[model samples]
Target: MANTHEMTVPVTRPTAARQPHPSGRRLTAHLASVADDLTALWQRLEDDPAVAFHQGRAWVEAWREATGANLCLVTLEQDGAAVAMLPLEIKRSCGLSIARFAGTAFSNENTGLLDSVRLADLAPVTADELALTLSQAGLGADVVLFDKLTPATAADAPYSALPKVFHQNPSFQLPLFADFSAVLAQINGKRRRKKMRVSERRLEAMGGYRHLIGEDDALALRLLETFFRQKALRFAAQGLPDVFADPAVRTFLRILATDRDANGRAALELHGLELAGGDHEGEIIAVSGLTLKHGHVTCQFGSINDVIAADVSAGELLFYRMIERAALAGHKLFDFGVGDQSYKRSWCPQRTELVDCYVPLNLKGRLAAPLIAGMIRLKRVIKTSPGLHRLATWLRGLPVRRQKAAAEPD
Candidate 1:
């Protein structure tokens, strides 16, 4: 297959002089080839506190590690002062290239980190000039995946008209309450009270519900392993092969953790809820690994140990706590990241759509894009279809018992 990636050039307006004008004050895209510039810019920017990768000295270092194909950075400068910055990474595999955000698939959402205050004050001339400058920059990518964008920033983005640029639905955001009482009120007053009642009774009858946010260095790695094991087995049992079962996928996460850790000097957060009591002591029921990006917190990867704690509501409690911590930390958003789940809806009334928009750059690739999209849509339909899904599960040698066994350590 040829390198079949789509490229989007910001739509431009023809100048009165009959020239196409770039939308923003000629924004400049520069390769963060200089460590000093990147480090300085990252530190000065009001980045999301939850994400360590985009802050301080480490962000520059991460760029060095993942320097494969050059997608470079778009630096919007106003009179020599850096105003807006977008870090982009381009990856090539299987003879195809795609431009996603730097560390995106793993990142909950990445922002262009433009100065809304400055942008808001700009005249049409300034906006066009900036856009033209960025447009002229020698940035090349087959496809641009502008991951999860905050509503505020996305609203002001100059490149919104770029092909395939669309806002995903409002992502799920959980309101962090000041106290447990506030949290329970949001979950359906009566239902929340009942659940809490049940939880208290269970705890009194047993020992207590244990919540752990592993602070150990090895906790993140271990939790990630468990999550993958559970997720893979679950998918396999459902008659679907785990897409992330590939080593490269695993390697990417490991590398991501290591790289981000080295940069931020902080380990990933791994939250676990366990059933602790009686003969079955310390059985893990739910686990989640979340990534912090500046002031934005996102639930990255996680799994629930539903077997032993089916009655305990460990997962719900854990998530509830996560929101509390996020709110306490003053995080603006707590992204459930991607996916639609019943629990997510309970906590968040808002949701954003994640779309894979395509603009075929080449004739052959263009023709194939629609077909590929249809195929993807079809796969989703089949996977979600109840009866066929069960059949597929059976064919995949799926059994709950076997799944549990496979998940256990030797």
Candidate 2:
């Protein structure tokens, strides 16, 4: 049996409740009391076409295993039918309870689930009501943070509508076409698109190259291992924290890579570029991790071989092939996910803006919210400025440098 914690917030008529909504049905908010109930609610929400893979049950389960956070799944129901749901994971930070959307650390999109039927009827609780319930739920959280939420999610999703500090985190996306050539034609720079083909030819001339899409678990695992190693080297060189260094996160990704949904489609798809001959024969030159669902393919993470064949732009070549694959699979969108990269802009013409919403549940939270918002803003400024970003990178590498020195022979 799965351990569960639940709380129910009653709602009378609109006149009685603190927040007012359109008169149609009285909705009551409650946390899932058991694993069975949570699973059932999750299934119902997953049925909605708006629910993304990150907000799905499989991803949530993987997050639970990876982080072991206290699950707090809230549901708003009308006449016993679930209308909305917000999945959260609670943890203590700096002696204060903090609740954030489940899988926020790794998930590119964090959209709360909402029943399409209820949404059509405009019967689901508003953002205000949801926030009020969470604040009074007695979950002992000092603050609730919802990150990377978009306005289109869940009928005016609370993250963007709530009275809180909003921080920008934009994502890039490309609309897929029926053919690869059509997609390439839409890219802004003609020279850039031509250059991509030149890069592919360059890679081909060096013996040969192949785009490998791993469907089998064994092959996927091998590719994933390579991805981790390459990612570690890249991060170390850039002086950035290696998030994949954690064993738990690695295990979670491995499980995700191998997992298939009821439709037999993998939760995570592994794609790589392999050199067929020469000094780098059989070497995985570049690898990209992706998630496909509801006609959308999201790039989770990707890395390339900077040491060998750097001039060929293996990563860019890999993306061209992957985008073609997604287009052939009838996907509607190819999302670069959250980031500001020069390559992303080359492929994705549309920029989807995202925001982080923070709500204080108590006195302590009130004090922490501004500090958190300021920090996020500062980081954004640093990331956008090349000089500051380089300085920040150097500062981050100091710890690793010290560790290396300590291990060196005297």
Q: Which run of 10 residues does model 1 get worst, by summed lDDT?
A: 1-10
**Tens digit of lDDT per residue, candidate 2, span 149-203?**
6645512533324443324456788889787677766774466567778987887
Task: For model 2, give the 10-residue run with minimal summed lDDT.
Answer: 1-10
Name model 1 segments beyond 4 Å from true. 1-25, 33-37, 46-71, 92-96, 121-136, 163-170, 197-207, 248-267, 293-295, 328-332, 353-410
lDDT of 1: 0.55
Find the candidate with the highest TM-score and give its number: 2
Q: What is the C-alpha lDDT of each candidate?
A: 0.55, 0.75
Identify the runs in model 2 with alpha carbons over 4 angstroms from their true place.
1-18, 21-25, 33-35, 120-129, 154-160, 164-168, 188-193
The pairs that clash in candidate 2 are none
